[model samples]
Target: ERRFSVDLVGEVVRNFTLTLWNTYAFLVSYANLDGWQPAAGGSPAAPAALTDLDRWILSELHTLVGSVTAAFEGYDVTGATRPIERFVYDLSNWYVRRSRRRFWKSGAGPDKQAAYATLHECLLTLSKLLAPSMPFVADAIYRNLAGAQQPESVHLADWPAAEAARIDPALNHDMQIVQRLVSLGHSARQRSKLKVRQPLPEAAFWAGADAAGVIARHGALIADELNVKQVRLLNSDLEAVAYELHALPRELGQKYGSRLPAVRDALAALDAATAARTLLAGQPLALQVDGMALELLPTEVEVRLQARSGFAVAAEGGLVAALVTDLTPELVREGLAREVVRRVQELRKSSGFQISDRIRVRFQASAQIAQAIAEHHDYIAGETLAVALQAGAVSADAWLIDAESLAVQIELAG
Candidate 1:
């Protein structure tokens, strides 16, 4: 009955593989798996010390287990598949994306061990859940993650029962709100045409009292994802965004004919905020003009948000996330430093350097970029796993970022 898009199907498959399978592969690649016996995707592993982030993902995993289990029991294949897809997104984009540092940090400490254990458990459970729909991939992931700990194949493994004690509903609710705010922040960044790599000064949010607590708890994660220096709360949504009304000229012209201009004028005269609210609430906008009353559906008009000065804002479902678009000198320097690290990392990859390869870095750059390197020397060194950074002749590859050319070389640490 409805139009189908091959692209949509492709996107879903790609997201599922990249988030679940590829992420698992990445973890296994980096993980020091010697003597580590992964859990058999049973009840959740309760690490002695768990960060809020760790606990949050565990909660999500168990919740997914309960939902998928119920759906499969009812023979609702679609329901089972959909929840797995969503969990893959959360695990890949939110959990793994945020926890990459823990896995990559120099030492195998308790925190690192916990992370490995938690992720391993998740992938194992996910493979079992996916077995019915995607058998081959599920068996492959389960075999790798579980090793000799469980049945050789995922189909032979027992169903992962939901761990009631591990599923924290409150934590899940808070994380959901945090994810919404971060998603809005990303929209704002897209509108501003600024990439995530370019750090911004601050992001402000306006939401209900309920979400205030969530924002307070996960503000650091939000800031990290949005590439903002700080997260602030605004008392009102109007402070973050103003609505602008637009008439769909062609549609309105076809509907109103001779009265199209009058309709456009009426729309322009209406209070944008009130009109937007009415339309978003699924009510027709009522206008009185020229002694006539007219009601226009949401389809006849467009609503645009005008961000407050120095901010790029996105608002939806009563939540607003605004990013301060003005780049301060210090912020610009930090962004450049990140760009340099990214380029260096790319060079390392292209040069066939292993993830654990420590390197000596040498760079020749324009004055401004060189200054950025000087200011954030330790940061760049730490991020790129550079044993030494020196000013010298170019050797490897040259990259031009922000109109500044940087020639950099990285060699294995002696």
Candidate 2:
């Protein structure tokens, strides 16, 4: 007979329960499921007007379906879980997280409907894909999403087929690069002890030719993700920064056994700016040693960037880096406005206000924060679903909020 400890079983049960509850909270609460459902045709159709983010997610979904199918066919349970996990992460973290405002916007328009449809499709597809390994959880999601229209049991549903036409390899590749750059941008902010909610004036990305092109194409996304007003590709600007080059001893030694010392000395002595420019241009660095010219490929030398005095930089594999520390007065004001919005949101949550609830806000702030609120009145109101926002004293029943050492009061409308 197999024996299971009660403590171990209790822990497992608690974890499972929390996981299900969190999943439900995300789908029903965060995603606003009341407004999202499969349409009359059954499966949610791809929206007619799809943004780059939407298209990229759809492409990823197609890729995930193929991976899951292959893994299941090969009887590799662990392999199947990998794609499911990745898809879920991307769906919740990237797609839904970024598209929250679109869904929460007051009116239902084509764009809003499209966001709903895209997310709905992703969730439903994810349900069917996950049904094999997590039948109970999958059934709950599937039933709530599609039980009324489709098969009652998730197990009875057919496996989701990959839509080859929806798969865009180029877009996927570009999005992956963008994701990496955004993650590095966050790392840069964390290193500088800067909060992401604070808006920065600009961020510069130094990437290889291909990655640079993709970054340029998706510059706006990088900016938004990093909470910066502008994203500038640091192609020419790389010369302004300092670079330290280290010759890989093992690789270079194998190529030039006796000349290794000369190569190392030459590499260290090379003009940092010129070497950066040369490597960025995808050209080999030519060195003259012992009356013979030897060419050093870009890969033969590892490059490290020294963050300039006014910049905070985070680099990955020396191929990509982001600089984002400059803050102008205007940018600081905007950052203050963003901070105010966050504080108000926290107050709303604490007051037990529903996501759709509108409130009246009155604030008494420092001159700087008040000025910021005046400048971004409409923006703050829109974001927080405030029916009215003004500078004044708080009413007795109003919720009080403190942001950046400034006092604010908010009252939900009946």
Candidate 3:
């Protein structure tokens, strides 16, 4: 086994680097832009003021603290380090990535304040937890997030204690189900060669009774992540897929010889649902084919559920998720608009504009792309923080999105 290989070391470094840059540094920069400062007490907002996402991450944080504390107390350094690494990944990838809109929304309110407070609390606690293992990096993060709120050095700060009152096991379980469903949904999309940016009509998940509440609470997040208009809870897997009887040509050919074709036809004609149930119940299928009675063993026929038309599906551990892949004309146009927003945002970054900088955009695009821009003008402009969008001549740095040439130029709004 290559468990301790250099590749593992590289992966560890990459994970830490991504967490630090995307989560820690990015949040710090945004805080500065918003003129936000951490509270001296370093307390999170009241539960009622926080969103489900905020509560979920905070719950995860306390859980991590408890596990790390127990591991360190028992001298299990590896156990302690493993949880810390995983927490950082979740903090960056899920929490921060998902809360970006909350942070970016204009003006100040309880929601925005709660988002900042929750994130600050998480970072402050993490700095303290990492102090023993990573003294220098921990100190840097502590100084950046805590400022004058806490001890100057992370090493001087008290070890973080788990807040048991904040930990909700039920919420954690629901979030786990939601994450797994999202993962399965993404896999289905990939299998269908569908891009994440392409807007779809609906996605459905069936993970038994336990997931009912989970879907009700977190379905919006799923729809947003999967780029679907709606998230539907499937009552049964049958709604998303159809089980059909497939006769094994080789096995049936040996048994029935010249009657094999007729046998296949008979199996195909049988009510697939009834035949599947009968076969699964360990009974052979009784069929009348060409005036000959046929008894097909379970091994002679394969039962498989075909994904419903217009859906790409994936299943695991009795859970099934399906993504509707059919694209309507409106959906296609909306997807194009999303692509335009992505390109413009990329150009803004590459052009070195500040995050708060309002921009004016001009573009020359194919007819289809132009039509998308015209139809979704407000959405494209609002998303990109663009003051105006005008049709004009474009420069050489053109982008190709969905096989359509789009050339855009952006400047700071006057």
By TM-score, who's the top model here?
1
lDDT of 2 by residue, 202-240 (tens): 788776788889877999888888898888777554532
Best-matching candidate per lDDT:
3
Tell me which of candidates 1 and 2 scores higher on TM-score. Answer: 1
Clashing pairs in 3: none
Between 2 and 3, whose TM-score is larger?
A: 3
Candidate 1 vs candidate 3, TM-score winner: 1
User: Which RMSD values do the candidates have, in order?
Assistant: 2.9, 5.5, 5.7
| Candidates 1 and 2 compared by lDDT, better number | 1
Q: How are the candidates ranked when ordered by TM-score, highest leading?
A: 1, 3, 2
* TM-score of candidate 3 relative to the true fold: 0.84
Off by over 4 Å in 2: 1-24, 30-36, 245-267, 270-304, 394-404
Query: Residue 127 error for model 1, in Å?
Result: 1.4
In angstroms, give how far residue 63 of model 2 lies from its true place: 1.0
**lDDT accuracy of residue 383 in candidate 3:** 88
